[model samples]
Target: MSRVSLQNPIASLEQLAETPSRKDGISEQLEDDLRSFGCELIQSAGILLNLPQVAMATAQVLFQRFFYLASLKDFGIIEIGMGALFLSAKVEESFVRMTYLITVYDHLLRRIQQQSTHTPLDAFSQRAYSLKSMVTTSEMQILKRLGFNVHVQLPYGTMINYLRILGLEEHDTVPKKAWNYLNDALRTHVYTNYTMPTIACGAIWLACRDQQVKLPTTPGGEWWLLFDAQPSEFQNVAAHIQRLYHRKLDRQQLLSHLSDTEATLRNS
Candidate 1:
């Protein structure tokens, strides 16, 4: 795939930042909207493979950032999703081999029970080549649209670093359930629309609470008390993030919409 033009990545991001849409309070709801049009294609791919949550979250950020600047009409959402996943793998330092990704995709198809008569290896090779071509072309457009902002900071990284700094032992660290919820949080435009660092911290804290991690809390503020006695200081940011979670869109509802849209697309 060709790289995006070396002109300016910011210009494209500006365009994405300005697109108008109805506000759905839940992060998952917004994610469903994006997925309905194939925007979350990579995310689905990650889910099927049980790839690390960090990898999935990284892909989501890339998708949002790319869409912020580029139009979705010329390139289908599936292409963008593929490119986002490929790019994210590189960004997060996970670096799944092209062959491995292809294998995973093939495995996913079988797991989902999609009709495929080819051997897993054969199916993977064919699909990988196709996905690679699409991603190559889309990468060029994405880079041009993004003005070359390839450095995407992820919440997972931030959250882990914060936890370490707060002297939380790995055993007492953020629970898996909380981590999963935070992973979902990354799917929303919240990172782009709000203060991400603060929200990430808050999400970890909340996750810890949900799992009963026994972390201390501030008296009445939005910030939570960490083990080291320093507050994470997410008062304002936490409020917004909490509100979004409180108004979370139902997963089943989103799934129904996705199924309907996929059916329509296939019919078309």
Candidate 2:
């Protein structure tokens, strides 16, 4: 649920012995933090470029995969984050100019500095020239790590197709919500852990549950069995989406109550 479907998870000792360097990366917690931040940057770039979620999703996957092979110690996380956005635009065929991208990256870095003034870190991070140089290098490194494997599989498209099959293409209920859910999934390691098809099924199921749309397979055995999907895995996917919604609702409620209290004080 929290991961994208992994491919060939089982590793023979021979393979592990051959690739011992992979073990020399950052700590688990550090990797988690960096991956989360990288996704945030990708989301920011998407907003800045007015790109679609597809691009955002692609960029996030690139960021995740790049870090899987290359260590953050070797390359700046932000550089690869932006580079992923740059590379993903091409992969998704929604190319944004490098200058525009640099501008967005600089803006985000400046914001970080304003939030907490650091020393040379802020100085270097805010430079357009430095960003350009590092991102170009990071992009090459990412491509090399991926072995030029720029293609990414996402549940967004598969989910849409499935919704279309269900005749909910224009319903705005399941498909739309599912689309948002798919985007939300990228914020976590969901893409790295779950299979694309399972993610699609889970999103659709969660959307349907929210919309109160009746499922044909409900009140029965694994609803997705007909589609060759594991119901248990899909349940995990649903749970992830549900958690996102619960967290979102909690924030909204907190904000609403805070605003109401402020209003009361203003009137008093």
Candidate 3:
């Protein structure tokens, strides 16, 4: 029996399309900051829980939707990030307690402070409060934004289903490697610009290639199945996702960007 449950997938693009962009200029900056924070938080939570790509993706979706309605200035980035993590765990059916979630935040804050040479508690407290308030308010907003669509089908679930359909159990190294690669892909912000179906198809294709899976065709043919399964409106989304993966985003580059951003945030 599969450990994960199959559920309804989130209609994220639909929700995002309906949400009117806030008029405040700062809202854009706040969204960017919150997105960065959400990425870090999701990375941390994935490590702590040993979560799969599907869970991380679900969390990302939840975080994005929450921020879509709630302003960063009102709730604070930290609290909203934590809350998103908390809510994502529930959505993914991997429920972690709020206390443990807070502890994780505390640990993460301390680590950030140690790296930046700043006081953790003082710097993070106000932001944390803001996160809390935003989460409290945005929780409702997220539900409404989603049209109470609580089901969130993850790529991990699809991977597992594929594995089962293939009848290749017994911890195959190739599939496991492919799964990890897909999980890493989920962490990137590129998915926001593409439809989930397209992203999933691309991630799965990349993972299979990384594992040297004997695909029907090199790339295009294998993706045909995904395209057929995807909604017609998002047909072109795969092209965009493919473009993102082809672009360079090495670890060293990401680390440099993170370091520079952290320094700026601390100095500010």
Error of 3 at 173 (Å): 5.1
Off by over 4 Å in 2: 1-30, 115-126, 218-222, 241-268
Candidate 1 wrongly placed segments (more than 4 Å): 1-32, 35-54, 97-130, 164-174, 208-268
Each candidate structure's TM-score, on Cα atoms with residue i matched to residue i, is 0.59, 0.73, 0.58
Instruction: State candidate 2's TM-score.
Output: 0.73
Residue 255 Cα positional deviation in candidate 2, in Å, after optimal superposition: 24
Give candidate 3 regions above 4 Å deviation.
1-23, 26-36, 49-56, 68-76, 115-138, 163-173, 189-197, 211-214, 217-223, 226-268
Pick the winner on lDDT between candidates 1 and 2.
2
Worst 10 residues of 3 by lDDT: 231-240
* Candidate order (TM-score): 2, 1, 3
Model 3 clash count equals: 5
Error of 2 at 52 (Å): 3.1
lDDT digits (tens) for residues 1-268 of candidate 2:
5654335122344532332224654444445555666687789878978998888888998877666566555556577887888888988899798878877876676565354653333333435456676678778888898778677877766777777766778885677788888887776656756777888888888888889998665455645765567878887878865655444223343233234323432353
TM-score of 3: 0.58
Q: Which candidate do you rate higher for TM-score, 1 or 3?
A: 1
lDDT of 1: 0.55
- Per-candidate clashes, comma-separated: 9, 11, 5
- State the lDDT of candidate 1 residue by residue for 1-268, as single tens digits: 8765422223234433344222223343354355433434566787765667677776776677665554433344556676677777776776665565656654543443355565666533444566556667776776677666766555565566666655553754464554555666655555555444655666666766666776543475333333222233444434544555556445565445344424433454
Give lDDT per model, in order.
0.55, 0.68, 0.52
Per-residue lDDT, model 2, residue 244, is 50
